[model samples]
Target: MSLLELRAVSHGYRQGGLFAPRTAKSVLRDASLQIAPGECVALLGPTGSGKSTLGRLALGLERPWAGDVRFDGAPLHDRRGRIAPVTRRAIQAVFQDPHGATSPRLTCLEVLAEPLRAGSTGKAALRDQATALLRDVGLDPALLDRLAHRLSGGQLQRLCIARALAPAPRLVLLDEAVNSLDLETQALVLGLLRELRRRRGIAYLFVTHDLRLVKGFADRCYVMQDGQPIEVADPFGPGLVPPAMAALRAAILPALPGPRPLRQPAAANAVLP
Candidate 1:
C-alpha cells in the first residue's frame, strides 16, 4: 500500500472580499501522486504549478475540493474532519523558510521539546531528548538555549529538520526545504537528510522547482504542469523528454563552473623591465 496517496484531488482558494462577490480560484485540478514506504519521490515544477498545494493536500493541511487523500488505504481524516493525534504525528512538514517555520520568541530547546511533551513529562528528560535530537542533526547541544533568531541560516534549517523528526514521522513533506540555502549548505543538508532516511526509514515528498535536486536523491520523478503530474522515465537519462521536464531542465543553472584556460607565460628571452 502507498504510504501517502492523492487520488484525482482538486483544490482552490476563495477570491474577492465581501461585497465584491467571492469566487473560487482553482490551484489544483484532478492532480494525483503517490509515495511508497521509504521511497523518495520528487515533485518537480516551476513555481505556481500547484506542487506545494499537492503537498499540503497530502499532509492533511488542506482539504481537496474534489477527490480523496488516503493513508495506507484509509481516509486521511476521521469522521470529525480532523487528523487523529497518532496520524498527525505520523506525518510532518518542513517548509522552505526555517525562520518562518518557527517563532523568533521561542528558544531552540523549547521548539524541539514542544513536540515531545505528549510522552515525556519530566523537565530533565525532555531536555535530554531535545539535546539528542540536536546532536542527531549535527548541531551543538550547547546552543539549545539560544533563540531562533540567533542561529545562522544553515543552523536554523538543520534545527527545523530536527523538529520535524521529533515525532519520528513515517513521511515528511519537504517543500523546497533546501532551495534557499547556499550551494555548500544545500549539499550538507541533503546529505544529512539522506543519512536520516537511511537510519530511520522515512519517506519524503521532496517538492521543488529544480529538477537537478532530484537527480540522485529521488527514486522517481514527477513533473507537474497544469496541476497534474506527468511521470518521466529516467529524468536525466537519454530519452524523449516531456515538455514540462524540458522546460524545468532548461531553467536549471549549471551546477559547476567550466574550467578556464591557463594564461600563457611571457617569453623568457623577449624583454626585461
Candidate 2:
C-alpha cells in the first residue's frame, strides 16, 4: 500500500482585497502522486509550479479544494475538515528556511522537545530523547542552548530535521531542504538524509526544482508543469527533463566546493533560496 497518496487533487488560492471581487488562482489541477513505504519520491518543478503546495497537501497542512489525500488508506481530512493529531504526527516536514519556520523565542531544546509531547513515554525521559534525537540527526547536544536565530543555516536546518524525526514519522516531506545551503552543507545534509532513511526505514517525499537532488537518492521523479504533475520518470533515465531547465542548470550552477555529482549539472549546486 502507498504510505502517502494525493488523488486527483485540485487546489487554488483566493486573491483580492476584502471589498474587491475575489479571484481564484489555480495552483494544482487534478494533480496526483504516490509515495510507497520505504521509497523516496521527488517532485521536480520551477517555483510557482505548485510543488510546495503539493507538499502541503501531502503533509495534511491544507485541505484540498477537490479530490482526496489518503494516508495508509484513510482520508487525511475528516468530516470536520480537521487533520487528526495522530495523522499529523505520522508525517513531518523540513522546509527550505529553518529560520523562518521555527520560533525565535524557543531554544533548540524546547523546539525539538515539542514533538515528544505526543509520545507514550513519561515526562522523565523526554529530555533524554531530545538529546538522542539531536545525535541521530548528527547535531551536537551542546547546541541545544542556541535559539533558532542564533544558529547557522545548516545548524538550524539540522535542528529542524531532528525535530521532524522526534516523532518517528513514517514519511518525511523535504521541501527544498537543501536548496539554501552552500555546496559543502548541501552535501552534508544530503548524506545525512540518506543515512536517516537507511537507519530509520522512513520514506521521503522530496519537493525540489533541482533534479540533481533526486538523481542518486530517489526511485522516481514527478515533473510538474502547467499546474500539474505532467510526467513521471526514473531518475536515472534520459529524455525525461525539459531542455530549458537543463540549460539553466548548466549555465547557472556555481563552482561547487564539494565533489561534483556524477549525474547532475553544476547548476544543481546553486544556493537558491
Query: In candidate 2, how many Å is residue 87 off?
Result: 1.0
Q: Which residue segments of model 2 deviate by more than 4 Å?
A: 120-123, 240-273
Task: Check candidate 1 and list the clashing pairs.
Answer: none
**Model 1 stretches with alpha carbons more than 4 Å out:** 253-273
lDDT of 1 by residue, 55-169 (tens): 8888898889999999878899887879988889999999999989999999999899888897755999999999999999999999999997799999999999999999989
RMSD each, Å: 3.3, 8.4
Q: How close is candidate 1 to the true structure, as a TM-score?
A: 0.91
Query: How much lDDT does each candidate structure score?
Result: 0.90, 0.84
- Candidate 1, position 48, lDDT: 86
Tens digits of lDDT, candidate 2, 1-273: 998988999998999997999999999999988889988988887778899999988888788899999998899988998888888888999999998889999988889777887776665688789889889888888877777678889988999999999988999999999999998999999899999999999999988888667768888877787777755554434554655345435544543356867896659668867
Candidate 2 residue 252 Cα shift, in angstroms, is 6.5
